[model samples]
Target: MEIKDWITLVVPIIATFLTALIGFGVTLNKIKREFKYTIKSYLYQDIKKLYRDLYVCLEKVILDPMLAFEDRYIDELLNFKPDIYLFSSKNLIYCYRDFGTYLFNINEAFKHYKIEIDYEDYDYDDNGNVVGVNFGEDEVQEYQFKVSTYKEENCPSSKELKEKVENILDNLKKELNMV
Candidate 1:
């Protein structure tokens, strides 16, 4: 091809590459913002339910101490197995049959961001697929399970603490009634 023809063809190709790069940068920023907002909204809803349960638990404990797990806690917990997540991050939970019933807890798969994680940036798998999510702060959620298990020690005499946690958890369970 002549010099003018080569220049015409190559210049358009270069322009297209530059435009694509700009578009990708913009898309990245938008995704980050959207991910952050969605995480925050979900986290806020969870927190609200958690706090409400705490309030109820405090009321129950202050009013009555006879509300032990055996009375209604076990059955209630069995009915509503809750999946607890915290901050603006994606955390998974796993369970396996131990003896008879399944014991539930947080999934440590995302343990790299165990203490601290950023909700936006994450590492992708070799297949160019998103693999993990990270959050900024190393936030820890302390759930006060009302049931007095043989394992956990009581830091406070407040039976209400347990009830408070339970109430919040139950509410959360209902919220996630689907998945």
Candidate 2:
């Protein structure tokens, strides 16, 4: 065959190959973006729920220590930690670490102080009658002291945790181009 004939045959083959390659690349990139978006969306939702639940748990601890401590509050918090390590940024991981450390300190305080709750007591009416059973002074004072300590010493940590959660969410939004 002549050079021209050879050129024409090779040119179409090359063009078709190039076109297919480009299309595959584009499709691959689109898939990657979508996959990334889906994973990040789930991570964002989990983190948001964790943050809100942490706040609720903290509030519950303050308002009703007996009910709060009796439940699986800490276990619920633990459920989100592995996700932080797997999908979150380093900063977010560090923030979570700080929060965890704060929790550990609180737990240690409880253990060191030997804070125990006795689920027994009396209810005094306006007329000073024992209407029902409830927590006595020691238990009440212990909880009051815990509330005071949390308010004084732990509020800043809680605020820091809130800021960290907000920062992480902002970072995630930026990554997803939602910002």
Give each model's whole-structure lDDT. Answer: 0.44, 0.61
Task: Estimate the Cα RMSD of every predicted model relative to the unseen true structure.
Answer: 24.4, 9.7
Q: Provide the TM-score for each candidate, comma-separated.
A: 0.36, 0.47
Instruction: At residue 173, give the lDDT of candidate 1.
Output: 49
**Weakest 10 consecutive residues of candidate 1 by summed lDDT:** 91-100
lDDT of 1 by residue, 125-177 (tens): 89978787543343222211212221233222355345444444455444555
Model 1 residue 23 lDDT score:
100
- The TM-score of predicted model 2 comes to 0.47
Which candidate number maximizes lDDT?
Answer: 2
Candidate 1: list runs displaced more than 4 Å. 66-70, 73-179
